[model samples]
Target: MTACIDTLDTPAAVVDVTRMQRNIQRMQAQADRLGVRLRPHVKTSKCAAVVEAQIAAGAQGITVSTLKEAQAFFQQGITDILYAVAMAPGKLTQALALRRAGCGLAIITDSVAGAKAITEFGRAQSESFEVFIEIDSDHHRSGVRSDDPVLVEIARILHTGGAVLKGVMTHAGESYSLNTLEALQAIAELERSECVKAAEAIRAAGLPCPEVSVGSTPTALSAVRLEGVTELRAGVYVFFDLVMHNVGVCRLDELALSVLTTVIGHQAEKGWIITDSGWMAMSRDRGTQSQASDYGYGLVCNSAGELIEGLQLRSANQEHGVASFEKGQNVDIEQRFPIGTRLRVLPNHACATGAQYSAYEALDERGEARQWPRHNGW
Candidate 1:
């Protein structure tokens, strides 16, 4: 059954469940063809229901960004989790608890201090946590350089210090800044090369480097060969947003989640329409900063899900969004959408925007809505 449009609350995050499931299947299929494990990063969808859907689609393990997310998902019975962020001293207790609960907890760290703390915590607690040496592929974020001596040193500490040295992992965060496919492919190759190099380095040091994890939806989906990548850790593909589209990762039609909002006001002369959704409803994530065409927040769509030509969210306040169309633009947005009309707004960043909501209003192909709770904080 489809969700009755008249019954949904304004400024709610909705997921097209059918499309979401298909996205999961498509990603898994791609991973299968590449002969790698699909450890979908669950940070994009903190909703357990969404994770369950991913697990049903053959996700062997899940990736998360924070300890709170790890704890929340652990309580939901998800056993294998990779906290993709660097392991800090503060997160040791939580990671320990997750390990105690039968979770095969793995964390990424690049610094010696971080590694030592993690090793000490595991030892003191009598728990063995797995570790991934985070490799810096593009130098856009935290990670050890693939060729750095520190990579082998950290792996040695983890291997000898009661923690299992799982392997290496890296993210091509810089790929988001690429303006062309060639640039993205170049970044993808670097991602693969750096990760594989780190793995080979660890193995050369006589350490067991079993999993070479790599992520970034753009690189994961486009890279023709992930030669040494044992696992892929993409998160945003489940509910693609405008940023994914702008980055050449997915098309607008492939987006599976959007903000369901209601038109509340109109300024006929100015060609502006206001909706109940704003920065709070949609997030402040302007993932289009590198796009050729900067869509302020997202492309405004009509009730039937067609893009409203020339009408884009020009500005947003906490609870309101203003859409403006160029003067004399040949779009019939007003004729179909008046006050109280409901429509969906695709998000700029699925991870940030999706995190603002308490639950996902799952929708069917026919736009039927069902409720699914989500996790938040930390």
Candidate 2:
């Protein structure tokens, strides 16, 4: 086995490449069993190394949250990308450039105003584009009502304006509010029904509708059925976080990404151990608000990479983290974790935490280390 100290680094994100590949394979297998396309959301791991692995693992296409992400992946030769967010006017020129470079791009829109803006932009440009109508599954965020007349109206406009109407897309944001598997399943069913119904309405309006997209880590994993979903867009499954664990989607062992930190100080009287990792390293994502266990920031692991039993990172500031140990556990919060000691912290949200770093130190099954560069901003 490779020595653990050799892979140690302070304030860096570490990804177990072997475990990550396994997670990709497992998700692909599930998608194959369901006979649905797995278009993973690449926002979780902004590293091109991870994106290439997902593509190699049978991802039909990839989903990006921003046009900038699409541009980065496009430059890497990953065509056939879906910009899941609504296309804004400022991004029209960039989108057109991507299309000219031979990207099979599809963007989402929810209102006639947005559609008209795209139509006007397309008319001024030299290339035609594919568009998907965004449907509001639970009205928790941006999207047109699935059954709204505007759905049919927008499809007709896009088709008549020479924009290819691919289909409809919706996300069950409410699924995160679920307290049980049954509740998640119910939300998933609702998401599927809404997407399918929107597509049917567009078809009924004499438009060719070929795809129905549904996404969300919670609903995608727990949903017993994906009756009419043409593609699934999920990002968090690659690095199962504390939130996913609380929702019963994955176990802590399945998590592949974590922040590597070092103990910088300690207060023997107050019984607190301070680490160099803080909100800047772990992110401000408190996904455990609804869960019974609220790890203020994240779970702390010893230098050996094992969880410190009954210990939790109770609070974090800009650059310091305070860890609390269980009362009467007799653990040496300071003696055992002297200054310069290294530790690993599991974040509540992998995406937010991963974004804070410029690169990921990849580790193999034997703990060998390699660096993978990532992009940020915009």
Candidate 3:
């Protein structure tokens, strides 16, 4: 553990190792207490080292948004992967390749059309592909409704076609829109119960349904209990971005990821400090929008990662970011952060910010930077 950020280049993605491990342990403990396996989503960091830390901390398997993630982690010796998104027909060949290569990869589907496609492809390949049906607990995104008649239809299509119906999975993404614990817990329970009900429905029809999965970091952490959930999945909880902060899951100090930037210049009269890090580094993701507080681009912090009072990253261009004191707030921007001064900006979205970089300068307990590789694209 070393103690210095100046040794690393500016505008680099940095991880606080201590905080990240703490976060992993916390989530693992919650999953243990709830009696469910924690399949952490690797989409948040997209870094092998970070995912290994999670696995070492008791994450059973991993939930991935794309096949690229599935492939990347599989190469890292992690075979048990769940491609959580509805599998596109075009990707069946890729999934088959992984399954053939000894990767215990599972795919998900929500529509009968998708299920039929998987069924036909599996039959042609003589493969009993493992599949999980997506459940729409909060109706936020794609999934079959818990009580939808089509739920049984899709189950039959897969089971009859020699595909193994692994069970149902749901993500309470709407839980992110909530700030209070009461609402979050309600959504968590709703997510759990609805998914279990869907699985029960499938089993009652004589189809084999073994796993019932549910998640979303807020829901996973806020859940009062996990009655029938076989596993839980969440991504951003590893880094805990501004969106999660607004959702009341983590505190500012607990955030483990940040962008190390430098002050190259300043717009004096406008009270703006021009940063070398801009939209490119921050990924043009305004996730904090519509929340109780709108952090224009991101929250500004000093060289030590502490919040700069009344200061925020108000605007950003391709290669430049403008930081200023909030309206009616007074601060000498030029004098406070002059040219050549380095600082770290806490991003509004960790997943997006982390994606902007090819590698991370993971900070040790003493604040020293260590290079850790990461994968991106698709």
lDDT per residue for candidate 1 within 262-341, as digits (tens), equals: 99988766777889989999898887866777888788776556676676887889999988786678555577568998
lDDT of 3 at 102: 90
Q: What is the lDDT of candidate 1?
A: 0.85
Give the alpha carbon lDDT tens digit for every residue of 107-190 in model 2: 989999889889888887845679999999988899999778988889988988889889999988887766688888888899
Error of 1 at 373 (Å): 1.3
Full ranking by lDDT: 3, 1, 2
* Per-candidate clashes, comma-separated: 3, 0, 3
How would you encode candidate 3's per-residue C-alpha lDDT over 220-278 as one tens digit per residue?
99998999899999999898988889999999998998888889998788888999889
Q: What TM-score would you give candidate 2 relative to the actual structure?
A: 0.96
Q: Which numbered prediction scores highest in TM-score against the true structure? A: 3
In candidate 1, the residue pairs with backbone N, CA or C atoms under 3 Å apart (3 or more residues apart, or in different chains) clash, namely 2-368, 3-368, 3-369
- Winner by lDDT between candidate 3 and candidate 2: 3
Poorly placed runs, candidate 3 (over 4 Å):
1-4
**Structural RMSD, model 3:** 1.4
TM-score-based ranking: 3, 2, 1
